[model samples]
Target: MPQLDKDLISQPELWSLVMQLSDRRLTAALLPPVDGEQMILSHIPLPVATAGSYAKAVEEAVYDNPLLLSDFSRIGLLTSSPRVALIPACLDDKAAEEAFEATFGSEACVSLREPTWREAVVVSDDDEQLLAFFRRTFFNITIRPTLAAMIECYRADGLWVSCEDAVIRWVYNLDGNLMAANSFDISAPEDAAYYVAALRRVVGADRGTVYLRRAGASREWCAAMADMLRGASCPVEMVNASPAICRLGHSGADLPDYFLQA
Candidate 1:
């Protein structure tokens, strides 16, 4: 159970809630109304090795902190599963399912088209209970792939990487065209640097800058990444949350940049 501010408990309609569920943890952020100061954030770790544990953890968190039960102006649910495949939007349901299974072994999944990028994103997770829980608990909730927000935020010509938990989601744009949008599991700074270098080679994006979103990474880790990229002649720049989200006043200065997504 996490402690939340009093005002947030009293007036819920004035805020917007964003919840992100990953393999290792679930994160929830309460975005206050413009110029308001009471913002709340919570992170609950999931027992990854057990089946049906994700939903159990989420239910426990909600039970402890009823703030999650509040009715907000809007709610966004983001899933950060690594088992994601991006395909052309023209594919039909059957074809999309085939494509997803070909890339990742056959599994239950959902496919949604991202109109902004003109591509269809296929996401698969084995946790059926977790999906059911959200559907039963929240009203009019918008479920989206976390990659969609990352791509929406970096629509220019550059390489962008957003580090959250132990996963790094990256996108590359060249000449206003999206070259790649994918994620990788990284355990060390060296691993991240290696992926950046490999992605540059694979995408031929050797000249543009590398933008990094230090969502859940530490200062020491970010600094180490910057040093490594600079040594490779790739300029590194840190990206913060959207200006609109910043204006709403967040609990942490280093909140993930994908909160507002535009």
Candidate 2:
């Protein structure tokens, strides 16, 4: 089995993770981000009240039971008040717990973590921001690692990029696991070469990661191209003629089905 690891941005929604499971056997409660709004994918937009409140939001709201599964209408939590399901780390738990007790009178309401920033340039706004955010967040997690250490970590990382007419989408892994995903352009053949160059230049040539393109291009074409990359001293692995990678939406994109196995 592929060793499963969730690329957690913070300990927040439990349902999002459950839904992402390729097995689709698990279920969970979807909690509202600090604002009391439920969001399955995407950042828990920084809370409104204040940074302090945002911090608190992460702590107190997450819950343990009666995991919210479908939309509110489906579950009908409005008719019956079950324990509030919240993001574990969407807010600072220590702070949220203070609010939880102040309001709910205990540390019991908040739940645990869920697996889930900014810019730079080469210089498109999207790519720039994506790369910089990955760099920044990765460091934030590593703390005090020198450039060499960071490079050592990055060299092992990989990502997926595709465009047919404009851009089907692009997704990247900050760590070895899927960490972020996004859509760009529409879809086009032009996107194919552009994305490949970006992966080669931006991600660098040494990662040993594979790139799978779905340009309605031929397998003979893509495979031969992969072979050429090797001739250029670049390591290119498998190439899927189909658009399997793009099917992963927010969670799906970031964490491709059978991605671990790939």
Q: Each candidate's lDDT (Cα)?
A: 0.73, 0.33
Indicate which candidate wins on TM-score.
1
TM-score of each: 0.88, 0.28
TM-score of 2: 0.28
Model 1 steric clash pairs? none
Number of the predicted model whose lDDT against the real structure is largest: 1
List where candidate 1 sits over 4 angstroms from the true fold.
1-8, 36-38, 47-52, 111-115, 119-126, 250-252
* Backbone N/Cα/C clashes per model: 0, 26
